[model samples]
Target chain A: MLTKRIIPCLDIKDGRTVKGTNFVSLKDAGDPVELARLYSEQGADELVFLDITATHDRRKTFAELVEKIAREISIPFTVGGGISTVEDVQVLLKAGADKVSVNTAAVKEPELIRTLAEKFGSQCIVLAIDANLVNSEWKVFTTGGRHATDINLFDWAKQGEALGAGEILFTAMTRDGTKDGFDLEANKRLSESLRIPIIASGGAGNMNHFTEVFQQANVDAALAASVFHYGAIGIQELKKELQRQKINVRI
Target chain B: MSNRKINIAIIDYGAGNVKSVQFALERIGFSGVLTDDITTIEQADKVIFPGVGEARSAMQALKDKGLDTEIPNLKQDVLGICLGMQLMCDYSEEGGTEGMGIFPGKAKKFPVPLKIPHVGWNQISKLKTELFQQVNEASFGYFVHSFYVPLSEWTVAQTDYSFPFSAALAKDNFYGCQFHPEKSSLVGEQILRNFLAL
Candidate 1:
């Protein structure tokens, strides 16, 4: 049986982890590689590093950080944020990052998905969509969920799959940072609509939320940042609970 | 044990990233040279064929570099990962590709209603080869692929997604894994260590 994945997403700024991760074992909480190694050791199925750096040297620093993480951490990891061109993805993959996720750039140029998928197999290209419900419709948002687009969430996800996206990282902007729970309704609809695997992101408060996202929404994976970074829930404990509930988890 | 002298060659035909595999070897204290040269690969102590991409084009890339013919002829122990594993089979339904015929099976796409890529962590059970040395039964392995090689005598391990499929295949000097061992954490590192030990 394929286990439901638990992913810890870290926000990277200038190649270093921005948030103060609350892992007591960690020597330097600001080091992305240290946090990534800790998560991998804790049975994290995969990791995502979302680079929030805005400087021109973002590429060099992020690539170096990726190289360090790849050398140190054995678990698979994905890099995202400001990924717009083929060269950007090429550099990351070359640096040993297993996969790269594209959100805003993909929305701006839908062909970028096809190009990246064609160049670096669909398995390594994840299409991340930030969605918000407005007037009973899930509208797609870009530029870190700041700008709204008229694109329908389902339509865009379906198109992304057709364009050769291997997986969809659907993040509900409204549910994000709320820690209430995932947007089960929207995620369930999206998971059922797309042939690719759906990773439900945002609104993960506790172990129940992870279980609910898996059982109710039938998502392949659940991704959260704060709950994991702040030590609100431990990965091993969460997986054990999921296992007890008969939800298959890699323990 | 990995510090011992061994010529490791990771065949690079521009199909996909081999850096992860190289880095994984580094973690285990081994360095692999990335080369498409037949002589270099043929002379290596162990060969790692890693790839990710469309089957037809990957096959084309292999042929362009003349690795398509040389890969099978190598007398050294060879291991293929992911698409490299798929391409070692007799055929693949993806792009209707005819494989290198090193292994006796065909790769087919998973049936509909199941997720396409079969991504994330899954367990590999019924281990039958030394490649899984010291690895527990039904241990999880990270996988990301749309197509899978059906179970056959060459199957060393099996994983269930839509159904039982070849997680690892072994025959003679060639071994293949559908999952990325370099990215599968400790279990994967052990698998690589076992392979290098061979």
Candidate 2:
């Protein structure tokens, strides 16, 4: 059987790896290529580069960084953030990203998913949903978690699948940067409700948290930033622990 | 002529993932060129067809570039990945697309009862080809597709998803894998190495 994937997402700003708390109060991590190569060697199944660069010229720099990282790493990797057009997906994929994730873009222009899927195939089109708990329901938040849309998380995920999205990357804002572990209940619901693979993102404090998401939530993959970015946990050690727990992780 | 070294050409049919495939080859210490040129493909020591697109349109692109006819008649080692593997089949139910017929089989979408596009890694058992040289039976490869080639004489490997399907196919010098070897990490690179050795 295929093992659950452990993905370490890197937020790139001005071509450098950065870490933000709840998507704020950013801190410098390291060089993107150096960090990416280290994680891949440390037994990461895949890597995600979130282009958090706020400027136009910096986005181009991020593309070059993706190419450099692609040359350095052999495993599959995804590039996300600020991807709002077919041409944007094209530039990144041509730069050597195995996959591209679209969040706000897909929400703003749902047809963009179809356009990308038609051109690049649905297998590579990942729909990233950033959501937060609103009242009693999980609501989708867009614009980098600054704006909560009227879209419901569960409903939007299903709609994304219907829109030819191959995968759903669901990030729960409440648990994000809280270090209280993943929003397991929400992740579990999403995983159970959707037939497509669900990649649980945010709120990973330790290796056991990873195992918990994989075991309890039945997530196909888990993405963490700070736990991996700050070197708080080594990917190889985490995979080893997952193996000891009998959870299949790509080691 | 500085041509003594082996050259691998990845057939580009306007579909994507060719760069990633070439990168994988380079990462494995083998340089691969992405070209739709007939001369480049025919002369290379090995040819790779990495496909990631819709069936009808992808086949149309292959046909537009004349690779549709060129690929089926290749005498050298030819390895097809994912949709590349399916395009070698007799036909595909996806938009009722016709394949190169190098392998005697048809590719079809999973039934509605099962989830479409059997994505993610799964086990490959019942291995038969030299492609499985050092690759174990329990080894997994990353797969992402809604359509799958049915089991046939060309099937050298089998994987269960919805039901038993052709995970890998081999016929004469033509070979195909229904998974993404370029994206499948170490196990995948190992499979590519086995193909190179063959």
Candidate 3:
């Protein structure tokens, strides 16, 4: 049976994890590689590293980070942010990433999804959609949620799947960084519609939020940043709770 | 069990996540060269065939790189991952394509009422080979595939998604698995290390 996955996202800038990450593990957790190892030990099914720095120099640093992280951990690693071309995907993959998540570029060039799928296989392609509630309708956002597009959330998700995107990661802009909970209604719509796996991202406040998303939205995976990174919720503790609730976690 | 260096070549058909496989090797203290260079593959102590594309195109890729003819004859220990495992079989129902026939069997799509691509971590049991050394019975492995090889004589391990299917196949020096050992975490690393030891 396909069990639901719990993934912790590490937002990286200049090869370092950002967003209030304490300097506790300079020897073990301060470094992105060490932090990834810690998460793996905590029973994270997969890990996502979002490259917040888009500069050329940072790209090189990010590649190096990918290598270091891969050498340390054996779980599936996905690198995203500022990835706009096939070359970008190739660079990250060559550096040891298992998958590359596309967002802004995917919105601009829908065909980019098909090309990536054909060249690298759909399994390696993840379409990350940042959706904002515009006039009560979910609209796609770009440039880190500063702008909205005409692309409707449902239409774009199905198109992405048809275009060969193996997985869809939907981040609810309305709830991003709010620490409230996942947008259950939005997640439910996408999960029920898509044949492929759906990853529910953004607005994870506490342990109950994860349990709710898994139970109500039926997301194949739940991704959180601060809850995991800031240690607001320990991955092992959350997974153990989910298992106790009969959530069928890897733990 | 001296730590003498082993030359490993990862057969790259311009497909699959070969870098992940290479990194997995490096984690276990082995460095693998990712190349389609026929000589590099031929001379290596071991070869790992990795793939993610469909059967017909994957077959075409191997043929274009002259691997279709060379792989079946290699005397060194060879391992196949995901689509690579499927292609090592006799035939595949996908695109009605023929495989390398290294192990006589066929890969087919999962039937109805079941998810198409069996994605995520699932357990494998009935270990029939030593390549599973250090791996616990019913240990989970990362898998992402739309097609799977039906149970056959060459199958060494089985996993249940909707029903029982061949998770790993072994015959002589050739080994194949539908799961990505590189993405399967520690137990997966153990399996890869065991393969390298062989």
Candidate 4:
């Protein structure tokens, strides 16, 4: 059986790990490499490093950080934030990052997805959609959920899959940082509509929240930042609990 | 463990990321030389052929470097990962491409009702061969692929998603893993170490 994954997201800024509340107001997590090693040792299924403050000047530094993390950690990890061009992805993968996620650039130039999938295979391309529920509709957002687009969340995800995105990481901006729970209705719909794996992000508060996302939404994976970063939920304990609850988690 | 100064070569034909494989080796205290040179690959004590892009392009890259013929002739322990494993087979349904015919099997697209590019952690059980030594049955290995080689005589281990497929294949001196042992955490690290020990 393919087990549901629990991912701890590390928001990178200036080569250090930080997390933001709803994409604003950052909190210091720790050193990227040390935090990554600890998470992998603690049984995190995978790790994600998002260069939240990605800029042209910081690209080399971010790639260096990625290289450092990859050199030390054995688990698979994805790097993202401001990834627009093929060269950007090439540099990161060459630095030993297993996969690279694309969010803002993908929405602007949808062909970027096809190009990346053709160049590096779909397995290395992750389409991350940061969306907000507005007027009872999930509208896609870019620039770390600051800007909105007219595209519907489900439709864009389907198109992304067709364009050769291996996985979809959907983050509900409205529910993020609230610790309410995953947006089950949106996640379930996306999973049902697409053949690619869906990663439910945001609104993860406790162990039961993960259980709800996997059990009710049936997503392939769940990703959170503060919950795992602040020691609110231990990965091993959560996996054990999910296993006890009849959810097939990697334990 | 064998105290051998193993010379490892990672065949790089520009198909995809070979750095991860090199990093995985580094984590286990070994360094793999990245080369597309026929002589370098032929001379290594252990060889790793890794690919991540389309099968047709990967095959073309192998042929361009004249590795299509040399890889099958190597007598040392050779391991293929992902698309490299598919290229070791007789044929691939992807892009209607033919393979190197080193292993007797065909890479076929996964059946309907199952997602393409079956990504994330899955168990590899019914283990066989030294490549899986000290690795527990049903141990999870990270996977990300749309095509799979069905059960065959060369199958050393199996994984189930849509159905039981070849998770690892071994025949003579050649070994292949559909899962990315380089990215599969400790279980995958153990598998790599086993191959190195061989």
Highest-TM-score candidate: 1
Q: After the best TM-score superposition of candidate 4, give how far the Cα of residue A94 lies from its true spot, in angstroms.
A: 0.6
Model 4 lDDT per residue over B1-198, tens place: 556578999999997678889999988888899999988888899999998889998999888889999999999999999999999999999999999998998999998889877888999999999898899999999998999999999999999996899999998999999999998999989999999998
Candidate 2 segments exceeding 4 Å error: A20-29, B1-4, B112-116
Per-prediction TM-score, please?
A: 0.98, 0.93, 0.95, 0.97
Model 2 chain B lDDT-worst window of ten:
B1-10
Report the candidate with higher DockQ, 2 versus 3: 3
What tens digits encode model 3's per-residue C-alpha lDDT throughout A114-223? 99988888888999999999899999999888887988999999999999998999999889999999999999999888888899999999999999999999888999
DockQ, per model, reads 0.84, 0.54, 0.63, 0.80
Docking level for model 4: medium
DockQ: the better of candidates 1 and 4: 1
How much lDDT does each candidate structure score? 0.92, 0.86, 0.88, 0.91
lDDT of 1 by residue, B125-157 (tens): 999878998999999898989999999989999
- Each prediction's RMSD over C-alphas, in Å, is 1.1, 3.4, 1.9, 2.8
- How does the DockQ of candidate 2 come out? 0.54
Model 4: what TM-score? 0.97
lDDT of 2 by residue, B87-193 (tens): 99989998899999999989988886555567767788899989888888868788888998888878899988757899999999999999888877788899999
> What TM-score against the true chain A does chain A of each candidate get?
0.99, 0.94, 0.96, 0.95
Any runs in candidate 3 off by more than 4 Å, and if so which? A26-30
lDDT of 3 by residue, B59-176 (tens): 9989998999999999999999999999999899988988999988899988865655677888888988888987888889899998898888888999988789999999999999
Off by over 4 Å in 4: A20-29
lDDT comparing candidate 4 with the true structure: 0.91
Error of 3 at B120 (Å): 1.7
Question: Candidate 1 or 3, higher lDDT?
Answer: 1
Give lDDT tens digits, candidate 4, residues A59-156: 89998998898889988899998999999999999888888999999999999999999999999899999999889889999999999999999889
